[model samples]
Target: MRKALTLLGTGLAAALALTACGGGNNASAPSAAATLDPANPTTVTVGATPTPQAKILEFVDQKLAKEAGIDLEIKEFDDYQTPNIALSDGSLDANYFQHLPFLEDQMKTKGYKFEHGAPIHIEPYAGFSAKHKKISEIPDGATIAITNDPGNQPRALKLLESAGLLKDIKDDSSALTLSDEQNPKKLKFEENQPEILLPLVKDPKIDMAIINGNYILDAGLNTDDALVVESVKDSPYGNFLVWRAGEETPAIAKLEELLHSPEVKAYIEKTWPNGDVTPAF
Candidate 1:
């Protein structure tokens, strides 16, 4: 099923609600940001979600821009659509909050005119441990758990795929919906809030599970027990910085270059570790 990750509950509803307030109607598609104008370095204001992106941006805000001779100002947004609207209305210079696929869905469904700069980093989704040590440790035909939400469902499946538990991903580069899984591991799914995934990881019957790094951190787990990890080298889910179409100011340009710089890559590796959130340069 072509499911959405963000349409889950009241918070998601409130988030999507913002697009209804502003953005745009079914108008012409927005243009992508062009090459940077080094002559006029602008102060770029960007909105970001916490995890890897926001944390990484702080490093750029601190270091890389000075060398590039640009000032990058970053704003933090918990909700997804607000940044897009801010970008559209000229409230913010740009944003670094979403993946390219999610951005496409947002623009097409909400009639948004958004575009992305260079792809930034990939946060590898991983099967975590609260109880089990390995996939084989998960009892045969045991009910491994996955998130019931559509947005996270595929990632859950992919974790199982890495473990040799889930099978039949027709095309690794494209989306892997549940129906595409010709053979599934003997895994059950949990519809619990993404935040509580760590607690559930302790349940004996729960077997194995998949979780995003932020929630994993929230649950008090780091890179200690990631059984099956997401592959950034050849996977399709690397994240990118999103800006309004044709809105490449000098500051945005500098931020893009900084994001791909050597220092930023090292910062991300140290922050997340073991290619969990690798720099996708």
Candidate 2:
């Protein structure tokens, strides 16, 4: 599943690429190092979404676990809220959907603790102009459609800021809302799930959309279609696994290691293709 940014490392593995899953029967499991106990069953239950993270898990789950001598179990959740709660309640071992910033925000609002290691992947917020294929084609004052959710709206506006559609609403703003925008294009903000914005693009009324990678994937739209995209040069939105605070399981370590393994890198290369997603190992 896709997590909002704070819910945390590989360090910046080359700018910022949205990270997650992979596949293989057995190329070879890394030799059990002195670091972990092989005999103890280190099974972890991770929660995720469908494409590319969930799709990624389906690919890597079995081989990575068996190879590591750990049994990895992944649970799928289409909605964003459950996984975090599941992690909190002891219903899950860990979750692999949100980014550090998103998780941190969720923790503050919900009063739960979640953290990650390294930045995993970034699903860039791309500006998709229904009328134009290229940024140059966007006429002045076009009515762009951006998600209206409090958390995601600010993110969408940041993309608008980057696309030169709006001026800085806040200097140190890591997140944004419509109130922050100077409205260069006078774009009408339509708050809704990221997916809804795509269909609106079909209507002549909607000029553009700041679509997230998940919605882009759901719509089968490609990077080439985006008039603008999130600048990952120093982006903070990398997907990571969130374990309960004060509890670090051996399975968590195994899962983390496998995430950065050669298998996952290969999977990231195969799945994202556009180099948008990478295992933050």
Provide the overall lDDT of each model, using Cα atoms, as 2-decimal numbers: 0.62, 0.63
Quick one: best lDDT, which candidate? 2
Clashing pairs in 1: 5-151, 31-246
> How do the residues 1-281 of candidate 2 rate in per-residue lDDT, one tens digit apiece?
22232222223311121121111111122222444545765666777766677766666665565666566566766545666666776767777777755666566656675546555567777887668877766677676776643446667777777777777755334322334347655556555555457787776877777776766776788876678888776766777766766555566766767777787878788878785565555
CA error at residue 265 for candidate 2, angstroms? 1.6
**Candidate whose TM-score is highest:** 2
Task: Give the per-residue Cα lDDT of candidate 1 at 263.
Answer: 91
lDDT tens digits, residue span 130-226, model 1: 6677767776556555654344555666567667876764332222234534445444455554545666667877766677665555445666567
lDDT of 2 at 153: 62
lDDT score for candidate 1 against the true structure: 0.62
User: Cα miss at 16, model 2 (Å)?
Assistant: 32
